[model samples]
Target: MFDSRHIQTFAEVVRTGSYAATARDLGYTQPAISQQMKALERAAGTPLFVRAGRGLRLTDAGQVLARHATGILSTIATAHGQLKAITRLESGRVRVCAFPAANATLLPATVARVAASHPGIRVELLEEEPPDSLRALREGRCDLALAFSAGHGGDAAEADGDSDEGLVEMPLLDDPLMVLLPADHALAGSSRAELGELEQERWIAGCRHCRGHFVAACAEAGFAPDIAFATDDNLAVQELVAAGAGIALVPGMTLPLLRHTGLVARPLAPAVGRRVSAFVLEGHETAPVTALLLRTLSEAAADMERAASGFPRSEA
Candidate 1:
């Protein structure tokens, strides 16, 4: 309940000991300085100055306030300086929450980039699916989040399905959904496969939040998927498929982390891509470390997208 401006004026007047001189130093008129002193005294509930012979002298309360004012102003200046350093990327931390696929692919690229380019910045990562990540972001537990939803590189509203009500969304990856199969499977030799063609096959579902979309896709193709296995682990899904347990439909973004030689990923014939995007609380999009991480993710996704252009399948 103390006004910083009034404190500053009081401190300046204390130092100068002359109303006219304090006004001249601070670029205010003499009467303005006099008014500020009166207002400051009223707020403090005590007389601060009195005439002693021909000069102004501080009352006991004035001396106490003057001592505290110096410390308050110093703390304020230090806070401003640290904020400026963050703006320059000299020191800061960005808290991130993202799904497993993004953690494996995009998150690492951002971490390495920040380490190499701005050593002062720290990236703290948490693994969660889209729903939990959005909840964490909305609650301010995380500064930024990476999520994927059913879409084909569409606009934010379309990709988000209008569910994200009050966050800033940035589209990162337009990764086509692909089916993973054993290398020797009959459809493995095909350039593209249709969901209806694999309707009778046992299915291994991918990420938890994305399972609903996959089920809907299968139903739209006129058959309900016989999901024999479910897991959020991309590698496990690939391993199950490679062992001929079941085929899995996965986002192309995850294919980069796969290393099993027995599996092949192919594009769906109708071509619907899973949309990966970044989200931040509305006003935090421009925060220095967060903005840097987003840019790094965008660039890394662009690289993966370009590689996928060489083949319709995500060939790792």
Candidate 2:
């Protein structure tokens, strides 16, 4: 018989590629991790890993076990979640992760709705970018992930293809990217701003993904923007634009949360946008709390869609 703990240790070691790192993750000593691996090897009657230069490599048998380990772990998580749900959700917790803008706008409303109806169910929020959020979901650290795919031209299928096989993405909304400029700036009075119109302007970008999108849009417009500021905070991006630091391309979902006093936003020509989605592990979507939260999220997204309907769009 194989011990599930040993299986778990094997999977962690395989994932981190270091016994020491796995020990740190599982709160066990390095020697303890080695002992677990040895026990697992004896159960399988074959060596699983080969020592290679100060590191370790999985043998062929180890590779096969690693593949099965993923399924085993996922099944265990599903069972655990279902067991928790058997309490009628009178007392349970759902771990959720999302990017900043969603945390500010969408998630709060969804959480409010959940709290009103299921006060006994706790929803914990972890602020993480899409990559980290997805990682948390796969690693069993988070039950749900509110993530977005930027610069995907609003194609949900394309966005789904980009996610891991262990995750199932449910598209919620298409968030268009808009240009934010100082209220008295040259192009602020216009209902729209073409990418080419900002060729010589200084830019503020939020992240590497946002910067890449901005640079790509500029390239398509036949020029490169001089990016003057970089940050991951959308509110700070708006404040900087309001302060006349530089213009920025921001997602429409963040508009409701912005002060919008000293800045004006216009849609960009040849529009680029992000696809926002609710991601769950492959089989945990049926968990009661997860389902309720997802339903509330869908309702909140509908409200957002209605509110954003009046936003300006480029004429080109």
Candidate 3:
């Protein structure tokens, strides 16, 4: 019920034995210190100070309060410190959900940067496809979700209206889709190729969304893909492509992970790629963890996209 400022002034008065000195030390007028002392005495229901000529002396009540004030002031100072720490991003927890390829590529980089920079902010990652990840975000099981949308003018945020309200998106990177072909394939000699050019080749597709996008892109190019295989496993897809079973379209982020010998990755044109974005509730972007997560995620994806251009040709 008592003001911390008054308690602080009481302790200072007891320390200096003069209201003028307390005021000088605390940047208040002597009259203000005297008034505060009166108020403190009123709150305590007893006189806490007595005039001893040129200085002040403590009454028995004042002695008891001064004794307890030390601990009281210590507790108050500790509380103030904790409150201030909240203003700083010293600690926070962010639950993050990401798509499969993002989990393999961007999540590591994002978590690394977060650990190196904001070590106090804990990051939890969930590996899910865009649909499930976005669903979890809407369901409040996650603080941020990393998702993608197919070629829609390079901005997944607006492209994936996903038919949701109060969900905001931050566009992070555009990961161009790559064509994975066996080295012996007739088109492998070229560094780039068009989606339409491969219309006649047997196709390898992954995840429902990936297959749907590939088929839609093929339709746009005036052809239907002959998808002879459908598997979400990136390695299996690469193995099939390497064995000359069929060609595939995979994200640029997955390009570096392609390990099969005789597999060549070439950028598709008229360029096809997914837009990587961070999704959060409309106002949670300002949260410390979400803001930090968004910043780190953007930086990680940007770095990955920049490095994607330099993918080792010898391995691709």
Winning model by lDDT: 3
Q: Rank the candidates by lDDT, best first.
A: 3, 1, 2
Give the per-residue lDDT of model 2 (tens digit) for 17-98: 9999999999999999999999999999999999999889999999999989989988988888877765577667889999
For model 1, residues 162-219, the per-residue Cα lDDT tens digits are 4677888898878788889888889888998998899889999866567778887887
Angstrom error of the Cα, residue 171, model 2: value is 0.5
lDDT of each: 0.83, 0.83, 0.84
After superposition, candidate 3 runs with Cα above 4 Å error: 1-83, 152-161
Q: For model 3, how does the per-residue alpha-carbon lDDT over 65-96 read when each residue is reduced to its tens digit?
A: 99999999999888888656544767768899
Index of the highest-TM-score prediction: 1
- Could you give me the TM-score of model 1 versus the true structure? 0.84
Select the stronger candidate by lDDT from 2 and 3: 3
Task: Indicate the worst ten consecutive residues by lDDT in candidate 3.
Answer: 152-161
Candidate 3's TM-score reads 0.73
Positional deviation of residue 101's Cα in model 3 after best superposition, in angstroms: 0.7
